[model samples]
Structures are given as C-alpha cells and as structure tokens.
Target: MKNQFDQKWLDEVAVVALGCSLPGSYPSREALLDAAIGAIEAGDLKVVGRSSWWASAAWPDPTAPAYRNGVVLVETPLPASEILARLHRIETHFGRVRIDSNAPRTLDLDLIAQGRTVTEVGLVLPHPRAHERLFVMGPLAEISPEWRHPVSGRTAADLAAAATVGSDAAPDIAKT
Candidate 1:
C-alpha cells in the first residue's frame, strides 16, 4: 500500500512534530513544554503549529497514570537519522526512560512522518506501526485529518479507522 505515492513530498516536507504527555517525574506542563521547545530550538525544528489536550479516561494501561498529549508540525533540514538522534537527545533531557514499549513517559516526541520518505534502517516514515495506535492518531487527526500516509497512500482517517479501540475508548484517555 506504500508504493503508489510520489516522492516529491520528501523534498518539500521533511518533518512533522507530534507531542505526547505522560505521567512523569517532571513538575508540570511548563517544564515539559520548555524541554520540548529547547530540543526543537537546539535541533532547529521549525514550529509550524502546536496544540495541547488532556488525556481522556479510557486508560489503556490501567497501571499507568493519565497523560495530556499534543501535536507539533515541523520542518527540518536534517535527515531522519540525525533528526531521530536529536529527538532522543531531547527525550534524554526530559528524563524519558525507556522501560517498555508503552511504558509511562515524561515526554514522548515521535517523528510521525517525514515527507514521503520511508526507510527501515532505524526510523520508519509514515510510522510503520502508526496504523494501529490511537494515541498517535487522535492528536494527529486534530492537526491534519486529511494528511495522507506518504508511502502507504492512506489518509489519516484510514489509520484512525483502523485503530482497535473505538472512539468510545478514546475519551477515557483524555483527561478532563
């Protein structure tokens, strides 16, 4: 499903920043935002747009605390490897410890998509596993519902549709 699209998007659109908030040892949103902004600034991540929303009550991991996540649109001149490396640096700055795949985090900065470029060396464009994650799709839909998967040629709506938990379960994750 990823071969139909043109590669022009890569040269034009290099990076899109997506934000996720989690139960962290950090003090508050201001601190988290500062950490994120600092990373973007140091790595020269252009802030095209940004928005925040509390986590609904679905609570995927019953043992984990709720999260308030957001999305950011960015354009980076660096390649995926460099960008990912920079993102990790920012994550480290925020005290993001990788305990497990869905472990609670202080701040998770995911590289949702990098134009139409797709690779498996380390980073996957259009996020290889994006089709199955509601956490990523919900905030993304807010940013660009029509944003097409660069490689798969699938719309954000498609990925949202494929999410296992119905819309009913999402509100549970968003905090009021």
Candidate 2:
C-alpha cells in the first residue's frame, strides 16, 4: 500500500521520523497538531510526507482518553541532537509537561528515526523501542510503507503488522 507521493528525493536527503500525539485537548488535538506541524516547517527542516491522524486507546491505560497520533517525514541537515532539541522545544511550546510519563499530555513529539544513522549515546536513532510499537509503525507504514528499520532492515509494513505495542491501533475513522 504505497502512498501516492513522489519519494524519489528520499535518497537525496536524510529522512527523519516525527511522531505527534495529543491525549488532552489543548484547543483540540487537530488544531494543536496543525500549529505544531507549522512550527516544524518553520524550522531548518522540510516536511515532505505525513500520515493521516490515527486514533487509539491510551496505551497502558485504555480507560484514559483516546489519543490522536500521526507520523511526519522531514528532511533535515542538523545533527540528531539538534533535531531532538527542536522537537523538544516544539513539544514544550504546545504545553507538554515532562513530569509524568505517558500521563495524557497536550502534545507529545518523538524523534522515531533519522535516516540510517544510529547512536548508542543519549539520543538513539531509529528509536530503539519504535520497532515494538504499532502506534508509531502504523503511521509510519501509512506514509512510507517502504521505510525500513536501520538495524533489522524490516519494512515499515512488516514491523507494523508484527508490532506488539498498541495492537488496538487503527486508522482514525473520525478523521476520514
């Protein structure tokens, strides 16, 4: 299920994965996401592709409010550290609190991967745990099914189907 976008430039630039989600309304998740995307676009990166917002139960706590999640593909020239710093700034600008881990926040931005680059230090590339989460892989598959994990070399669609985390994940019907 390849998306209808021309991804030929994928080889010409470094592709960075961006995961965005909102479990709490900060004037509506969609609005906040739009603004966040704009902010990302305003930076030194260029957003080349995106997945439609998907809805899923709050992980580890299904009783909590559902989350609207999506993945964006951006081309960047900055190092992985700077790219992560920019993401953190965007998350903070959107009212994201760092105290509670996974406790329903206004905005959550994650750097899932950056090209084939990998690091063992603080900021991990091709996110060490991303391969286990469908909420992340599902959207990644949606936009770039041909994407492959840098280490395992598995396609986005492959890891997405084999994903263990967030099995209940699915396309957001409310959006379509």
Candidate 3:
C-alpha cells in the first residue's frame, strides 16, 4: 500500500507561480525574488516562467492600499496537495493572512493552472478568478498570452480586459 501510494503521488503535476504584491513586508523585487527562489529551491517544483506588473486596488477595500504584483510559472511533478502545502508554507513564512478574500498579503503563491486538468477538490485550476485581474493577466499575458483557459477558451488578455471594472493609471513596472 505504501509503495503504491508513493508511486501514485510522484506521478502528479501542478502549475505554480510566484507573485509579489505590496504593501508587502518586503521592499524591492530582489527581496521578493530571494524569498521566492528560496521556496522553489526548497521544494520539488520546476521553474517554468515569470512576469511582473503593478495595479491600484479597487475601492471596495479602502483601508488596504495599491499593490505591485507579479506572476511566475512553475511546473511540478508533485500532487496538488503537496503543491498547495508547500505554497501555504511559503505564504505563512512571508506573513500572509487570510482574513478576507481580497485581503492584503505579503507574498502570494497561487496555482494558476495545472496541466489542462480541471479540479474542485481543495483547489481550482486556471484559478477561478485569475482571468479577472490585471495584475494576473499582465504577467500571464507576458508569459502565456496565447495560453487558453481550459474552461473559457479565452486568452489571458481577454479576461484581463473583461474583468477590469476600475480606472487607474498603469504604474511604471517591468512585466515579464
């Protein structure tokens, strides 16, 4: 039983990414990168691609401030549970809180997509709201502009354009 379980687990795959947002505890991109790189090095994950961008927050949460965010693409041969566990550990290490859905976080590591498979176990892939945020789109578009969402068949760019409901000047940030 143990050997069978181990082999099954090793056959899994996950889509992973590194995203940075501020008012985070860390200051510069390098600082965030250091933390991200550290996590990747410590885990059974593969670094596929990465991108970055900046956007002001929408008004519903007035207390929290604007955020500068980024995206990373990672490929992992670990089960979804293992991938999420690792990401959760990294987020906790970076001081992320889960008080609310859109609450501010120090370092956010989300599983954007996983091998074209759709799941609702404990996580969702092509992240349910991924297409709805510019920060996500800007970076994803940078890396996977033509990458189609398994459910919608729309490109990352299309989702960014459709879900954006606010007006803010694009910040001076490097995306990709």
Local distance difference test, candidate 1: 0.59
Please state every model's RMSD to the true fold in angstroms: 5.6, 2.7, 7.9
**Residue 175, candidate 3: alpha-carbon lDDT:** 33
Quantify all predictions' global Cα lDDT against the true fold.
Answer: 0.59, 0.74, 0.59
**Model 1 residue 8 lDDT score:** 51
Worst 10 residues of 1 by lDDT: 1-10
Q: RMSD in Å for candidate 1, one decimal? A: 5.6
Clashing pairs for model 3 are none
Give me the candidate number with maximum TM-score: 2
Tens digits of per-residue lDDT, candidate 1, 9-120, equal: 4334543433444535557643575567656866567765454443533345655555555555567777777777888887887778888766667767777777766565
Task: Please tell me which model should have the higher lDDT, number 2 or number 3.
Answer: 2
Summed backbone clashes in each candidate are 14, 0, 0
lDDT of 2 by residue, 58-77 (tens): 87888867777778888888
Backbone clashes counted, model 2: 0
Better of 1 and 2 by lDDT: 2
TM-score for predicted model 2 compared with the true structure: 0.87
- My TM-score estimates for the predictions, one after another, are 0.74, 0.87, 0.74
